[model samples]
Target: MRSSLIIIGFFASGVVLGLSGKLPNGFDFDKFGSYALYLLMFLAGLSIGSDKNSWSVLATHNYKIIWVPVTIIIGTLTGSALVSLILPSLTMKESMAVGAGFGYYSLSSVFITQLHSHSLGVTALLSNIFREVFTLLATPILVSYFGNLAGIASGGATAMDTTLPVISKYSGKSYAIIAVFSGIVLTILVPFLVTFILS
Candidate 1:
């Protein structure tokens, strides 16, 4: 909870700084943002790599566990498709494209903006942000009712980072490797799936 609070604080501070428009000249926030994201990804990879248990856990788990990520993909796309039916303004493909973000809001929103429009990009951003928040808030309850796997599924791609703490807390330490693996797989699929559906 403390870590989550710190993260929220940093995010709020960044928003304030950006909105204040008092940043030093030539600061190049965009470039800095990209570098920061790259660094985050690198650190995530480093942590996973350094943890020998992650690999061994996967090795011990049955290969059928692959269904976890597959289920997440199907569920997200299907939910988006259902929503598109209610929202006539967005085509099935466009809605699926947004859903493909799978909680990786930053990269997914940027990708959608480049492929489609700023409006759709904003939608993707908000949708993925909601997914992450909802996952974080609901994982414990979901775990109680549906078990650890369901909690991990709720996290989508964020299982590797932002939502990982909540997932680990509620789902048990044994599931952490699964959460990271599921997150990595979903994260890799997000861009391809979004682009493919959009195209």
Candidate 2:
């Protein structure tokens, strides 16, 4: 909990500093945040890259991993959609935004904020935080019962960052594949997904 706070604090501080005009003139803090995200992904790749066995397994039996992501995506969509329907005020697109929390909060929030408004970003941030907390709390139990995919889905996009260690420890080496795949796919999907939702 403390460590998580520290990590989030750093990013949050960056936002504050950015807003305060502490960053160099003409240097976009938002763009810096995006670059930082990529760097984190690169480091995650390095960590996973060090494990040859995991990489080999991913290369050989990649199809098996897809089921996990498919299940997670379906679950997120269902959960968010159900919540939206129950509320009756939220739109389907808003529901989808809420459901995508598998660590996608920052990017999604930033995207929504830039394209739409701060309110949408705020919604995305809060929902994503909820999603991540749920993932962290349920990781041990879910890893035992629902398996790696559920665990991965719990962390959402975070499986590629600081949460990767937790995932590697709890879900085993196999999940590294899912983490990398989800991260890469999500990274690419961000712009497209946001555009679709905004439109």
Candidate 3:
């Protein structure tokens, strides 16, 4: 929760700076953002590699384990597709592309801006951010009504990082393992799926 607030603060600060023209005119956010996205993806993979539990889970070759991510992808895309019916501003593909972010806003927003429009990129950024924030704020209610795994599902890629602690506290250590696994899978798929959908 604190972390989310801090991130929002930083984002708002950046917005204020940009609006106030405090940044240098020659700064190339596009190039810097590209490199940062690559670095973030590398770090995500590195973290997954370092987690022995995740590897152990993968090593078992349990087909059922994949259902978590599979279901999440299906659910997110389906919901996004539904949303597109009402929001004429977004095409079906664009909506699904945004959903493919799975709460990994940084990479998704960058890819979206590069592939489409800056407005849609900002939409993806805020949409994914709200997805994560909703998970963090509503974990207890989600767990109470929807079950433990629902918290993990709500968290998306954040299940491994920002939302993990709340999920762990509410869902227990066992479900925490599943959260890590789910987060790892979603984090890895975000870029590829978003790009594929947009392309």
Candidate 4:
């Protein structure tokens, strides 16, 4: 919770700073942002790779565990399709592209902005942010009603980080491995899926 709060606070600070238009004149956010994202992704990969427990959990679990991330992908995209019907303005592909973010807002929004319109990029950012916030707030209720896997699903890509603590608290430590695995798979797929759909 404290970590989540700190992250949110930093994000809020950035927003305020950006909106203030007081940044240094020579700062090249566009050029630097992509490099920063690459570094972040590399660090995330290192974190996962260095975790011995995460690997052991995979080795112990049934091979069928692969289905978990697949189920999440299907369900998320299906829900996005339904939402597209209501939205009317966004096509099915566009909605699914946004949904493909799976709570990894930073990369998704940046990728979408580069591939598509700025408007769609904003939609992806907001949608993924909402996903993370909702998962954080509702994981306990979701776990109680729908089970641990539901909590993982609700977390999307954040199952590996931001929402992982909430999921671990409500679901169980054993399930942390599953969350990490699911998050890694979804995180890897987001950029490819979103780019493919947009293309």
The worst-scoring run of ten residues by lDDT in candidate 2 lies at 183-192
Model 3 Cα lDDT, one tens digit per residue, 1-199: 6765776787789889999988888999888877876787788678768978766766657687689888999999999999999997889999999888898877788778877888888898899999988998999999999888898889898888889999999999988878888888898788789889988
10 residues in a row with least lDDT, candidate 3: 53-62
Which stretches of candidate 3 lie above 4 Å from their native place?
Answer: 22-28, 31-54
What TM-score does candidate 1 get on C-alpha atoms? 0.73
Candidate number with the higher TM-score (2 or 3): 3
The top-ranked prediction according to TM-score is: 3
Error of 2 at 95 (Å): 1.7
For 104-194, candidate 2 gives per-residue lDDT tens digits of 6666766666666666677877777776777777788888897766667777667666466777778788777677666545544555656
Pick the lDDT winner: 3
Q: In order, what lDDT does every prediction score?
A: 0.82, 0.67, 0.85, 0.85
Pick the winner on TM-score between candidates 2 and 4: 4
- Which tens-of-lDDT digit does each residue in 118-142 have in candidate 1? 6898799778888898998899899
Candidate 3: global Cα-lDDT?
0.85
Candidate 2 Cα errors over 4 Å, as ranges: 1-61
Candidates sorted on TM-score, descending: 3, 4, 1, 2
- The superposed Cα distance between candidate 1 and the true structure at residue 107, in angstroms, equals 0.7
lDDT score for residue 10 of model 2: 72
TM-scores for every predicted model: 0.73, 0.66, 0.83, 0.76
